[model samples]
Target chain A: MTRRDSFLECEPGVIRLFGAADIGTKGMVSGWSGPEEGHNWNDGVEAACAVAVKPPVTRLMLSVMGEPYVTRARPAQEITLYGNGYRLGFWRLSARAETALLVALEPEWWLERGAKAVMRLMLHMPHSVRPKDINDGQDSRELAFCYRSMCLRPIAG
Target chain B: MAEPALLGDLRERPDGSFDGWCWVPGRPQERLIVDLLVNDTLAISMVAAIFRRDLQTRGYGDGRHGFVLRLPANTEGLDSEALITARERRSGHIFGRVLRAAPAVSAPGGPALDRVERQVDALWQDLDSARPPPEAERPSQRLRSAFGTLAGRLRAQAGRAPWPDGPPIVLPAPVSPALTVAFVARAAEAAFARIAALAPGLALARAELLVIDPGIDPEVALLSSRVRNLRMLRDGAAAGVIAACNLALAHGAGERRLWLGDTVATPSAAALLALARALAKAPPALWLGPEAAISFADVDAPLPPAVSLPARFGMALCVDRAVFAELGPLDPGFGAAHGLAYADLALRARLLGVDLRAVMEPEPPTGAAVEFAPASTAAWALFRSRWGALDPLIAGA
Candidate 1:
């Protein structure tokens, strides 16, 4: 197995950033969802990014929102960041991936402007892989087929 | 067929008594023999089981015996009403009824022990199922129930203000000249500010800070080195005020412990000194501020005198180490850090005989009193579902 798979298996609960993440409340608007909507925003981004990339190396990137404000620790394994940047706070790693990842990396100042803000990220994979697992590769084999990707979001306001 | 046996004729003995066997119904084991004699002009029987004072006092008493008529004919149907009536009057109260004669059948051997055993067993079962005797229930049962309720409360309070170690510290008189404080706040910056403002005023040989933060912001991290006595810890919003206080207390050492709110803007340095001094003069297991008013009353003991403070006031409490020796640490089950479970501790201090008293403050500290955030509707709903009958603390007394 690759080092990434071993790392994922050894500490499946740990949340790691693909690239640099800003710690602030303001960012670009990329995706939106209703509180009750069941649609997977990350998958939508993956599909969007998947089709946008060429066949040789199909790639997808997306951001998922997390809990609001700051907490001593994050409670979930798979976290979602919105707007710009990556790395958020950490929490106890669950051997199992979280059912849902919510990101509130932006500060209260930005949150007051709108109900929420979107965290940005990048996703990449080989052309042969499926698009479904692009953002949720750690969770499913289908997404693992996507090959490689990246995501970015801010940590605080 | 053989004739059944009848009551034998009673005969007077040398002690001016009558003695002989009497047949009684409802009892199949053996026929009773009653002996009668004159005692104080009453016809007493020697054949009757004699009841002594010592045996009576010890709860064992024999049945009473008196004169009974005897039947003579062997099996000639001697079931006459007159004879039965005479027997009834003579031993009716003791034996209830007189047995009639029938054709006797000879028994092969002595009565069956198994039959007797079965009968005894049935009797015991009846006794077992019977309602408890009135004497078994006393007024003390209520007292015990109340005490149990109070003990449960003490245990819960002990849980809210849990001691770090196995049990609370056992302190000697004139408590080892020590002080411990659990400081709580939302932002690491806010907590650091409180410590900076508080240290200069609290003149102590040693002081330690257990700071809990939700997120580790750079600003939060900056305060780590600012206070020499500070040890920073992090937890979720759900970890709560009482929980953070307990964690801090676990990491600290002092003869007396206090819960200092981390977010409070102003530090009442004088109030801390006054508290330290008040505890020194009149030592109780737990000390609180007289002005620290709790609007909640105990559901069990409603309107408990307001003079006493609830154990939840750990925010500024000075607990004697000895109290912890008797009761253990604060309970994490109360809720995340500033949950409402702190009030329950006040009830415990009272029930545990730890003497909960409020210190009168001549000059009160200045600052908008920090109160816990209001419980969410969902939180309130869950709390009521879990502890509806138990929660006595409410707003406006």
Candidate 2:
């Protein structure tokens, strides 16, 4: 079972990913599988994680580096990202290679609950599938993307 | 010297609205006047008169001592990062918690889209300026053109249908109607008959029924004469359900507006009275009723009051006219997919801190499931373009 306390900050604000620095599994609140050799797969249709941020910052840039579980049968996967409750951005990944998804978090979203708020990031992937259901493999866990890393950088107002 | 028994709290909602309940313990019957201060400056004052069942059940006089203040449009950009506090006017007491206002987010597409819109307008203006002027017509040609216009008008008039050709037949509205039942009649005569069946119940409850129809049904004219206070709107263009509902919203002469589908079972007079009472007492909210029949245990017994509806159960809704107008009219761009339009309105209401309540009856209405037209691809795309996929259930509905 994955726990939220598994996330660790490698530096002041940077969170390293995979192999003793797997922030994805540590910070994942729900909808995720165990860490793999060098990545973490987002299980099921939705995945959420909570990231703590220092106050007085007006905006934050969220960078999610991941690769979709695309195959010959599934040519592309669409993902919609949400911060708190507001939509941050969207992407359609067609290749298996890792891609960086960057979106700016406005003050309204970062400070939604209050001045000091935990930024909750959620990803919605409707086309997620179990490998066994598609005859691709015997793996039955619903997988959409394998996350390599995630970084949050604060931008001065 | 003891402190004045001031019992209440104020909290800021996610959408910047302020809601709280306050009453002097010694004077439970009195409704306190609360002043909202932004950055230590008084912004607005309101009477705590809205009802809250919790307050009443907890020993507050009548529960009509709560207030919900919607964020004023003018205060959006001005007080984005200010401290807000609610103070009782008479006692000079302030709420314990001071809320920090969230910065106002710009409209979905933001400033870049605004710039693009301006460029598109400029291009349209440039195109208009480049157009050639029309050639001056000779006197004989002008006379011939005038005769052609006259013949076309005459032909159009001759071919016009007798039923829905002219202006809509708007009968006299009820004097001081408590509720306005509004629905779009797409099935013409069948829809009109269903609405007409509710006329007697609506009249008994001092509710006016507004029917927006395509005017293609000739039977509607005769039915209109039979029903009292039945205002008919002829949507001759068949501008779809959202547009028709907007027309009804505009023409309805009632304190509260009930947006219903023609297929839903007609609510009894007692059920409508319960809805009206609940709406009257509660703060600004969208009250939703079950699609099935709403029957009371005794039919004559006191009906049950409405309760807060979970976000997922938001389907049909009723709203106060002012609140409905404040939230803005249904986007006619949704076209015939009125369900999506209502869902959009419900979403907006939720964002603005308006409660979505379920109007409950003693015996829960049962029977046939209510039918909602599946959203067209274009309508779904339009809705998604505005709201994204924030709520999957509402989006799918």
Candidate 3:
């Protein structure tokens, strides 16, 4: 008897990729567009998802593979990742090529906040742009970066 | 452009309860809050956020848009022929056709049910026959035998007295406990410490802690004497965790039972009370712990509302004594793989059309020092063999 609901909750160490018809909506909270061909675009200035990790995990590596929506008008896209309200890392993407953002999540960020089970990962992108506003296309939805996959693996000592 | 619509079915179960899935095709990600009405009168309200495998496979975003609601036994105007309908709580837009309640009926013992039962029994027999013969002397058993021989020789050479044997200690029956907390303890000292920490809360809720020790550790005997409301059940034959849990369940005197893991932190008094309240109001659903761990700092924080749980995620499970008795005991065939055993129980409940939900509450942080054993290969194989056809997403499959 497979508990169908467990698949809805994010499990630690399991890499869930976006754009899969079966599991693309696993941990999606808000600020994201519908899954596309091979990726999902962050819809607005902020996007968030939740994950549950084993309680003993003191540190983890948050690896996200995606491409920023950069154009000549906006040469760079600045992205900041936050775990349970604690800023984890920041990256600046200057090209439209796929970029992998790897951030080390320290214990203080999660353990200190009493987030032992589920950690909310919030991606803040102040530079999100709507294609229509930049004269690129008629699309009106605010888009920042499109993610292909995201993984949170525990860092062994 | 197509009109946005709620598509699903709301059927009355044989027990007069209602369960079904609903989602707006254009807004699959939105979890609709639905209301159940009996004869056009509101009966119950629930969030349609339970995942259904069929819904996912059929392209209903994530499939977490289902609900199972048990109406009160004495709900006004509810009868064998009452009209039941489901509608969106916000828009009051009704979904699906009206369903007439079915009279409660005893399980059918007809040919079809009997045939299914026979097939399942045959499958189990086939799996049992396929099991490989046990090794004559495993490495660990051989090492233990050698150590025992060396120790005996040393004792004889020194003319030391043999170890003393005494009858096993029996604990008095608890006086009508409201809840039973049971777990298999791999380490007596750590289990004792957890019990000590949880004693006050257990006492406040009139709960008894049943420690099932396979080793029958002497430390546990000593600790039981010191701790109030702590009961010890020695697994004298070293029967695995599954058997130990069944023993504890049989011997427990509580109205409700909490099957907990040794490494998971015990819930506080408030959390226990919350669970009791939820169980009282809920139908025969399997209540699980939150997906996230509750740390000491957040122990006093307000609990989130209960939500649907996937069967395999909880470290703790609470069920009414009657519900457990109805569902039957955990399958002993799982051996020491208690995790799979619990998941099996949940899945079995689901097969019987029971809801699987999580009780949101602040629980103690899990102990970091102890690492619980993973499920054995044989147990996993057996579980997959039994349930793989039903659930394609069996772990590692």
Which pairs of residues collide in candidate 2?
A6-A26, A7-A26
Q: What is the DockQ of each candidate?
A: 0.00, 0.01, 0.01
Docking class of 1: incorrect
Cα displacement (Å) at residue B72, model 1: 99
Q: Which residue runs of candidate 1 sit more than 4 Å off their true CA positions?
A: A1-157, B1-177, B204-207, B236-238, B262-265, B287-318, B324-326, B334-339, B358-397
The CAPRI category of model 2 is incorrect
Error of 1 at B92 (Å): 77
Q: Tens digits of per-residue lDDT for model 1 on A1-157? A: 1111101110111112211111111121222121111112222222221101111221122233222211123222232222233453333333333232333332321211133232233322112122233442243222211111122222222
lDDT of 3 by residue, B24-65 (tens): 887878867677787788766665766678788877888777
**Candidate 2, RMSD to the unseen true structure:** 27.3
Question: Clash pairs of candidate 3?
Answer: A6-B310, A117-B292, A117-B293
What TM-scores result for chain A when each predicted structure is judged separately against the true chain A?
0.22, 0.84, 0.84
Sort the predicted structures by DockQ, highest score first.
3, 2, 1
lDDT of 3 at B283: 61
* TM-score winner between candidates 1 and 2: 2
- State the lDDT of candidate 2 residue by residue for B1-397, as single tens digits: 2434786766544445767778887888885767777767766666576667778887888776767665446653344334566788878887433324233233343344435545755655565467633557334346544543443333323332112333333333344467778776654446545654565567566677777766444333333333333455667587766777777775565778777755455666556655566556666666554431222222223333443321123224577767776688888888777766776776677678775543433333433122234778898788777766664433453
TM-score of each: 0.31, 0.34, 0.35
Clashes of each: 73, 2, 3
- CA-only RMSD, every prediction: 42.7, 27.3, 27.7
